[model samples]
Target: MRIGVLALQGAVTEHIASIEKTGAQGLPIKRVEELDGVDGLIIPGGESTTIGKLMRKYGFIEAIRAFADQGKPIFGTCAGMIVLAKRIAGDEAGHLELMDITVARNAFGRQRESFECDLEIKGIADPVRAVFIRAPLIEEVGPDIEVLTLYKDEIVTARQGHLLACSFHPELTDDYRLHQYFADMVEDSMTANL
Candidate 1:
């Protein structure tokens, strides 16, 4: 399956590498046309506002929304979590409003406060080592969304319909479970369509 990584900014190469390592085609999506052939998409960690601006500037915001509306799976991480939230509490910039949840950007404080911790993900058997780098926290998840992982008494990962969001940087870690989970989701969707 082909997956597109939003190449607007931030950790694009790392995400590409991770996706490739998962045995999927990793397409660096810079333009709207690139969205046509991908089965799934990844919005990597970066400055949310800047990425939002670039998304709009490059016409990727609407393109991505259109793809999501078509039932394509999307996995967003870190600042990407902010981009996918329905509402953003602490930030003035807001988000893409894809998932029905509220997020607080940089809720864990500054870069100096960034840390790593073992996360108890709901489905995964082993603890996932999650890296939080100025991450966003899920302040509220809508009734339909499923909470996947939590760290230090806060919600760090969740899924709603075809949209999956993570507050920490999974790409920064060696763990491929999250990516595998997303890939499995994509595979399920593909099989269901058949």
Candidate 2:
């Protein structure tokens, strides 16, 4: 299986390392053309507004939206989650607008930047470890969205069909189950298309 990490910004290398641990070839997607070579794509943690501007500047907005329309799975972590959401809490315009959810940027507040916890994701058993650093929170989810893991009654991880998102930095931790989960989604999408 092959997976691509959005290389426009964020923890590109770290995500690649974690993806490789899942026995999948991880590629860095710098250009829109690079999207064709991967079965699934990951948008890692980074500043949301900057990532949005860069994506627009590089022509990834339409390219990635097309990629998702092909039924290919897209996983967004942290600010990446913000990128996918259809709504942002403030007046900030949404980017990609792929997932039917609303997100609050920097929802964790300034005091708890390095908060860690074990979360019980919907699919994965035995609670997965999650790290929150300037993470966004899923304020509300539409009917299409499936709530995965919640932190203190707030939505942190949720999946909608082929698109998956997490408010915290799942790539920062050693856990690869979330990556595996996304990989499986990609693999499944490939098979169903056949």
Candidate 3:
């Protein structure tokens, strides 16, 4: 299986490495055309506004929305999760707005407050290592969205259809279960389409 990491910004190489550990070919998706070859996509953590602006500049906004419409899996981490949300806490509009959720940017304070923890995500058997650095939080979720994991009673990981979102940086850790779960989601979508 081939997965594409949106290389517009953020942890492109790290996400690629994580995908590789899942036994999937990880391609760097710098252009809209790159979406065609991959069965799944990852939007890694970074500055949300900058990523959105760059995506608009490079014509990735609509293309990514189209890609999601195809029923393929797309995983968003940290600021990427902010990008996927339909609404952001503040007045700023969302980027892709693909997922049915609202996000609060920098909910976990600033970089000085960055920390790590082990989370009990629903599908994964063991606790997953999670790193939070200027992370966003899922403030609200639509009825169809499934809450996957919570941190201190706040929503952190949630999934809606083929879209999966996490408020923390899963790629920064050595755990590959999240990537594997996404890969499996992609494979399932492909098989069902076939």
Candidate 4:
């Protein structure tokens, strides 16, 4: 299976490294056409507005939506999570508006406030290491959304069908289980379509 890391911004190399650990081909997707070669896509953390602008400027908005429309899995980390959200807190315009969730940008405060923790993610056997850096928080989720991990009772990880999102940067750590989980999702989607 091949997985793509949206290479427009943020931790792209780290994400690619993690995905490769899952025994899948990891490719950096810098153009809309690259989406066609991957089974799943990972949008890494960065400035959401900037990423949104770039995605739109490069004609990736429609292409990625179409890719998701095919029921292929997508994983969004940190700022990428904000991009995937249908609603952003404080009435900010949403980007992809794909995942059925509301996000509060930089809900964790400033860069100095960034921290790391081991979280008990749902469906994962043990705690997974997570790094929260000026991260966003999932304020609410739609009925179809499954809350995966909560830190201090605040939603940090969630899943809605083929879409998965997390407020923390999982690729920053050596733990590849979360990436492995997403790889399984991509693998499953490929199987179901067969």
Clash count, one per candidate: 0, 0, 0, 0
What are the C-alpha RMSDs, in order, of all predicted structures? 1.2, 1.0, 0.6, 0.5
Off by over 4 Å in 4: none
Candidate 4 residue lDDT tens string, 86-161: 9999999999999999999999999999999999999999999999999999999999999999999999999999
In candidate 2, what are the lDDT values of residues 51-170, reduced to their tens digit? 999999999999999999999999999999999999999868999999999999999975355698999999997788898888899999999999998888999999999999998877
Instruction: Give candidate 2's TM-score.
Output: 0.97
- TM-scores of the models, in the given order? 0.96, 0.97, 0.99, 0.99
lDDT of 4: 0.97
Measured with C-alpha atoms, the lDDT of residue 16 in candidate 4 is: 92
Query: Which candidate, 1 or 2, would have the higher lDDT against the true structure?
Result: 2
lDDT of 3 by residue, 1-194 (tens): 89999998899999999999999999999999989999999999999999999999999999999999999999999999999999999767889999999999999999999999999999999999999999899999999999999999999999999999999988898998999999999999999899
lDDT of 1 by residue, 64-166 (tens): 8999888899999999988998888965656578998899989999999999988888778899988999988999989999999877778999999789999
Candidate ranking under lDDT, highest first, comes to 4, 3, 2, 1
How high a TM-score does candidate 4 get? Answer: 0.99
lDDT of 2 at 17: 92
Best by TM-score: 4
